[model samples]
Target: MARTHTPRSHLSVLHTSASRFASSPAFYVPQTLSESGDVASWKPISYIQFLHDVELFARHWAHVLKLDGIPRRSVIGMWLSGMTYVDVLHIYGLSRAGYIPQLFSIRLPNPDVVYELLSRANACALLVDPSFEGLLKSCPIPTHRAATTVYDIDSHDMPLPSLPTLRERDTVFIFHTSGSTSGIPKLVPCSSSWLDSAITKSHQIAMPSGRTKRNQDVTVWMGSMCHIAQTFMLLGSLQHGACTVQPSRQAFSSNELSLMIRDCGVNRLNQFATFLAQHLRNSRQNPRLLALLQTLDDALYSGLALPREEEEWAHGNGIRLRNLFGSTECGAMLLSTRGPEMFLQPLDGMSYAFVPVASQSEAGTSQGGHSAPLLELVILAESPDCPDNSLRAADGHFHTGDLFQEIRTGCYLSKGRDDDWIKSENSLRCDTKAIEDNIRATCCDLVAECVVVGNGRPSPALFIETNSDLPQPKLKREVLRRTRQFHSRRYLHERIASADMIVIVEKGSLPRTATKGNVRRRVTEEAFRTVLDKIYGTEWTGTT
Candidate 1:
């Protein structure tokens, strides 16, 4: 029998299918399932079978938590990794059952921190992957004493029943920000309507053609499922009925990813800049990638800035690399394709506004003592002025806290975060993004990622990850020389002299989240005090 394709104007075609299958058994397909003892693979599942699993899980969850009597909007926390398909199902099922699903990173430093976040969210139930069971057991929250219903996927013997239909406006998931620079990450509740909009917008911006709807075009993801970028891609692919290729437990090797790209026949590839850089560096000598490169249609880079040479290499290989700018708080914001103009175009159905940061403020705080500089984001509104604190030229636009400048006609280049700009003694200001761009342009093939941070210190510091296997001293000297050559001599002297130290690390040592690499966190934890002390022959507490 031929499957029917229903067209929708505002919603994605996949969302329509999901809604249509909510009550019908014929629509479910068991695409992902556990095979053998521990292995899992994608198998065809009927819409009815999938709904059965959802119902069973939802019923068990509600009964376990006594949610039968609780009101709607109750928070349920999900602390799991990306490998588990059940996590996706559980989230969707919970939303269908009228509960709010709070998604959190399992990378919390300690169990206490995890417990504190869940407790603060007032989560009524907690769904955990088996790997973190020990952490949960060690936490102060007693398993049997709390109102939370614990759903453990590893223990499949547990009882969980199914639930009925769900509402479109119901909150589906809640994501908390990483509190690296400020107070605790606040919970951002997401509704079905939001997901619908996000999925549609992402598909339009990413795939953008009926060709994407074809079965042969696979979507590749490298980041963790916890990160919104990965989440968006995973959900968007599933909704579009496109195949998704997930890397194994081992971090994606350049060889491995290159192979997967060819094997899966991936047409649309999305990943962080770091991942792409590492893959390119690793596959520099591999011959198979040339063929894989031929099959790839769109190569979308997000999470960080792509090195200029890497971008050129991809274009040289016939792949069009597009830059995606967005956050977990906001969905896809800006996209730039490979063209002579190379301007970032605002996504359709979404508008942006920006608020300028005060020049004197620091990176993680505003002049008013707020954590992080304040940039009002005006959503659904347009802006004519890019960085100035001018009055609203139009209504309905949000003022975004991110700093940006219109460098060319219709091209807005991102400066650093409002607080991340470094000011030299000569009163000259440097944007980290600009510095990163300069480093990429000068070093081209040597550098992977570079971060410039100035935190109420005398000199700004640059932390760089290099692709070459050169020793630390040689790499440091090379970086310093390049820095002097690329930047103005006076600017380099003022900045480098005021600069405390330059730290070089191997690729992949730096910490990265789903959206952006945490340069500050990596410096403080991995390089600064520990690595810098050994290199500089002193204890350092200069900057964050």
Candidate 2:
């Protein structure tokens, strides 16, 4: 059957870009770096070269599939790390060569979950980095399915074969949820039409005020490509004609990042909020990194929320930090470009609704001490903002588990996930994220990181991770004093009942997701089950 051609086909876009910007540098890879965090040497891959590389990979994979007798358009599961050009190239090349690429994080802790995802995706083959070839043996996949590493293909300048036509609804790429909340990742297939619409919207969406990255700006992605954010951002950069730089290492130190910024003339930084916070913390001692950050056009972050203190520090230091808001199921829909408070605005032409959540109170007291309405963001399925039909609910809208607080008529600030709400024994519910944010904002100096528990208990308990040498009692007193001051107006069920509920944990010891380092709330709660039990003295024994 003939497949309908979509205008947003990435292969077509790459062809157009290669012709339009043949000599333009598509990516800059760090070749060498000095001990003093100086870029000693680097290599730039031109757009023409990039297209040629894509074709080269496509041809190599095509020949491999021919030898293995795997049919075209078969789903191929990829487990590549290193965050190098190889990962990006493999994804693009597979799509161009008429195969669906299913991306998997190398950091997925369970081999069973990986096998299950692969099985669910009906993956006919596996492509992996050499380092991860052991995964093939670890998973009990069918022996008939072919498995190949990056080095298995021998490249030659054979003429590229005709690419297969892909239908609008055909799956081009497959992504997965963060699985931090769900405990197991869910597959999210990116359709051709959906991706096309996403790319088109990317061009229409306005960058945050005073924080836009120009087409000629140098951008660097600081996370795994397995993440849909990085992959989609790369496409957006391509559409915008921005030159991206791939760091020498998958995981680089703050000093190494500074060197990349210095040597690569990097104008935009795209990283997780946690890493950005870490850089800010490191910048306290290393003024050079801070200076380099101040010089950047914009620091784009997503994944987790940046700590309140670190966010303020960035703004005070003259760094423009923009937050990209979206998810694997829905793609990017919102961007925070206005100011340090990180209020999000929807993309141009994207229709969304902030349905007010039924809270116990008439209105919740927000961080600004104003009675703000709490709403859950919903993307109307009929709107252009809707990515795919996979996650659309029976109501015909994609209900993002994300909750936002209305700052104004159109602007909204993230208040964390809907599941982040804690229901007490009395049936009163409070936002765990809101309480934690308040405590962190007020007790920034006393608490490095914290989590609030007691989902079905009488009251919430606090867990703190701090670097201060103060005694546990004094630290609890100080934290409680500040938190109480911040939560004086908040409902009693929303506040920690007493100082005994504040448990001090070791710094950097919170359980976090492997990909973005977001603290797994449920996992963290489970880790301190005994301590929480002791604090509560008794379980509510009610359905959470």
Q: Pick the candidate with the highest lDDT.
A: 2
RMSD of each: 13.9, 12.1
Give the CA lDDT, 0 to 100, for residue 257 in model 1: 55
Clashes of each: 32, 0
lDDT string for model 1 (1-544, tens) is: 9964322211233345446554332211123334322213333334445555555566555555563355556877777664444555566556555577677655442455556667876776666665667656655432321112224422234554333233554545667543221213445555555665676666666453453455434666545455466667655555545555655432355555554555455577676665565556544576577567556666776655555676667667665677787666565677884653345667766546545456633334332344443343355432211211121234544344455555444455554454444432211234455556667888767788877654323345677788878777777677667776434322221244323377776677676665555555434444455655554453332322
Q: RMSD in Å for candidate 1, one decimal?
A: 13.9
For residues 69-149, could you state the per-residue lDDT of candidate 2 as single tens digits? 777888888877737776777878777778888887665534566777899889877776666556466565432222233
Give the local distance difference test score of model 2.
0.71
Global lDDT of each candidate:
0.53, 0.71
Error of 2 at 33 (Å): 5.2
Give candidate 2 regions above 4 Å deviation. 1-5, 33-40, 138-153, 156-158, 180-183, 204-215, 249-251, 360-363, 385-387, 420-544
Candidate 2: residue pairs that collide: none
